[model samples]
Target: MDLRHLLAHEVAAGIIATGIEGAYDSVSCSTAGNYPSMGVSQWEGGRGDNLLSWIDGGRKFIGRTYSDIVNSGELDELRAALDSEQGRAAQLEILAADCLDYVDALMPYLNDSKCVIYAAMWCPTSTNVVRVFVRNRKSWGYDVNNLSALADVFADEYYKAAAVGAMYRQGYSNRAYNTYNYLVTHEIAWELLDA
Candidate 1:
């Protein structure tokens, strides 16, 4: 029941929901552009120096949580233990001793500008997008200038395609955003003891 696993599942759900891989594949990671991002969060590397910054943000989480273990100057010992026969148990013990409940630690991350934008981009329901926007404003310490307009744009695109009966017939298309929302609010939320 480590928070990391639960959040991992939640991130996986977001990945499957967003078709972000498609977006990533289409955009060049090396060039600054408007599309193609990294991971489920879709942190757009195309904008400014954000590509590497996005990666560093994710790494910062690990670094913050395990700084003690990392900074103890015992990497050689840790590596030895990891290579030993009882590596699994030893590794778990080490990790448990060093890491906090990452799920609780993950809330601030969820409200990150990149994550908020991704949610606003991919969340099928306007309500959830609004919730994300509010969290970004109130809890995440973001100014959130034009997110309402952005959310409106997302909604318009969703309804327009739906009205045309475009991707609805397939059932497993981008409408999977519905399943994504359900899983995040239900399964992933339950795992986090939030539901």
Candidate 2:
């Protein structure tokens, strides 16, 4: 039950179905995640500091906390920020940039990335060594057939924060194929089948 092997198998099926060339580079024996991004390797509790920033809108958004909006029924400075034209514009700008990056990551697969990567969860992390899958994404015309199988399998582990899990990757774009999401799905599907 090699997890990476299973991932490559299914992804091969997906690639064949899509008729695309190289959809991925290395199925490294590693995995990573990002909030609203990668899958939880472990059952992380309560979001904590990671979620705290998300609530405060430090990343793509800012302004109010779940409590402030859900319970207090009041908009904070950040929420108020979105209430204006500029704030909405800013958010859109950030989203647009993300989309651009995302598309760049998927450039290898092009139009059919969805069928292979799956639109529901294919999010590619930046072009770096994410946990294990060493992403060499810049190759313009990668024939996935030429790619070799991984020597080991990798997936995110989960438990309470008290438990262990792989550190997630950073920086993302909102382009065509989200490599992160695809990896998560690949990892999960392989784990379940292997289990």
Tell me the TM-score of each prediction against the true structure.
0.28, 0.28
Position 109, candidate 2: lDDT: 43
In model 1, which residue pairs have backbone atoms overlapping below 3 Å? none
181 in model 1: Cα distance from truth in Å? Answer: 9.9
* Residue 180 local lDDT, model 1: 36
Per-prediction backbone clash count: 0, 24
Candidate 1 local lDDT, 1-195, one digit each (tens): 654444444544444445543322122232344332332233343321233233322322222212343465543443343334453333233222222232233345454332333343343233343344445444545443343433333333444433546454444234434433443354334424332
Question: What lDDT does model 1 reach?
Answer: 0.37
Model 2 Cα lDDT, one tens digit per residue, 1-195: 343333334443443233232211101111233211111111112322232243334333222333433344432443443334553344333333333444344334433333223321232222223211223321423332121111111122111111233333111222122333444454335335335
Worst 10 residues of 2 by lDDT: 35-44
lDDT (C-alpha, whole model) for all candidates: 0.37, 0.29
